[model samples]
Target: MAFVGVERAVRQILQDDADVFALVGARVNPAKAEQGPATPYVVYQMIANEHHEMFGGSAGLANALIQISGFSTSKSEVLDLREKVRLALQGQTSVVTVGADTFDVRSIHLEGDRDIDDDPRDGSDAAIYGWAMDFRVGYPEPVP
Candidate 1:
């Protein structure tokens, strides 16, 4: 699926970055958080997809809204990770290969980002900071 292509491309780009890997250690996940990673980790999910119609009402393109979140005990560190994810995804226009299908990513637009604070799960006084970023990705339909 086109979403698969987009996810693969995003994961590949983020994992290839030395700074991101050093911080998160390959903690990128799809729609779920990793059970036991030190402090910082990343989780991504495809929230929505809207198919675009051509002049004759035939849909051949779509835009996917993907959410990538960074969680850490340090606010600054999580924000930095959010920035890294943004840089890796924004404005990408490459042809990504997923399985046996090739899809072209038209563009990646950062919709918005926010910071979250929550109490620790271990009943500690400290709070964990999470940074979430939403990216709107435009890509071609998967070849059938």
Candidate 2:
């Protein structure tokens, strides 16, 4: 792709959102995000936020995507990659470059009782419930 072409393609791609997949299509669960987890090639463990009795919300779903970028075709490579991820996740990794993307949303929500950050002295204007909308984009990996 040429630079000019890439610019146009990205502009179009940015205009749309990725399609979300069913969590239990072939697995066993609901779904979250516009799409599912990244990949399931080399899962060291399950990423979930399961409660003692039941699984939590998207927290459980988000945890399902494991990071295997450091995986190596050889055992030595795997060991090295594990160490790299360990250090990287621990803020030991130095980024060579960085990039980001954003989205424009309309309506949004603020749940939980704590969202009420109002002045107690002026309780007359206190809010019982509120609602709004806003665009949201996903940045699956940022700490790296």
Candidate 3:
């Protein structure tokens, strides 16, 4: 069987955490959250990926740069949520199963983070506060 993608594995990892679940439940989404998503949600996307090579041949390993963003009405809440995300993923190494596929995470590192405030693009007055976190994940390539 082929291995699971890092996005699926990361979502599973966040959902499996009690602290993160208590804060955002299953609101972790890919690229973006649901339309009008409730306060305190997380959105993640794979920003970059690099496959290693040795002797001009496949090295059977990869590094993925993923960005996880948390959004909420309250700035403090968004910050708290981002912190929970950090705790759940930083320095993590584990096996995650998404459906029948397995992902063996070799290492995870918190690369950077920042506060971001967004004006509603829909012309709504709701103030949206956000925090963006970047992580670099190392893992073996998926079996073909």
Candidate 4:
């Protein structure tokens, strides 16, 4: 499969994806970069993997990328999204606005990946593969 379209996939999900509010903090505090309009409030990303971005300093720039992030077509797809975020935050990237709502994402990074193993099927006495996910995201604020 082609990996080039991950950006579109991410953008599509961020805008059209349901369950957005649950992944975000209960309230918005613009004082926190990670909670402000600039940041990508991805509640689905958090829920899918049960992980959130690590924030430090003022801007909380994500230094690490989430492993097994649910957003990418492949492992490296998240990194491409990161570059898009970097460009957006630096005024180098655009067209990320979500719907008529005007939501945005920033300070992108990979949070981490989830590890999974095969499950033994008792019925057939066979092994079955399963899937797990990890979340990676960028914070809008600088690391404190």
lDDT tens per residue, model 3, 74-121: 888887888889999999999998888789999999999998877664
lDDT of 2 by residue, 29-135 (tens): 22221222222111122222212223432321111122122111244433433333232232211112213433222111111111112122233553222111111
Residue by residue across 15-134, what tens digits does model 4's lDDT show?
432333223223222112231222222212223322234453243333223222212223343344334333322322232443343323443443333433333323444433222333
List candidate 2 segments past 4 Å from native. 1-46, 50-70, 91-144
- Lowest summed-lDDT stretch of 10 residues in model 3? 114-123
The lDDT values for all models are 0.78, 0.22, 0.90, 0.31
Alpha-carbon TM-score of each model against the true structure:
0.82, 0.22, 0.93, 0.28
The number of residue pairs in model 1 that clash at the backbone is 0
- Name the better of 1 and 2 by lDDT: 1
* Candidate 1: segments with Cα more than 4 A from true spot: 1-3, 55-57, 97-102
Cα error, residue 88 of model 3, in Å, equals 0.1
Candidate 3: residue 115 Cα off by (Å): 0.9
| Backbone clashes counted, model 4 | 27
Question: Candidate 2: worst 10 consecutive residues by lDDT?
Answer: 19-28
**Per-residue lDDT tens digits of candidate 1, residues 1-144?**
335567776676677778889888878888767554567888888889898776777477888899888888887888888878788888877776655756678899999998866557566777788978899988877433
Per-residue error at 68 for model 2, in Å? Answer: 4.3
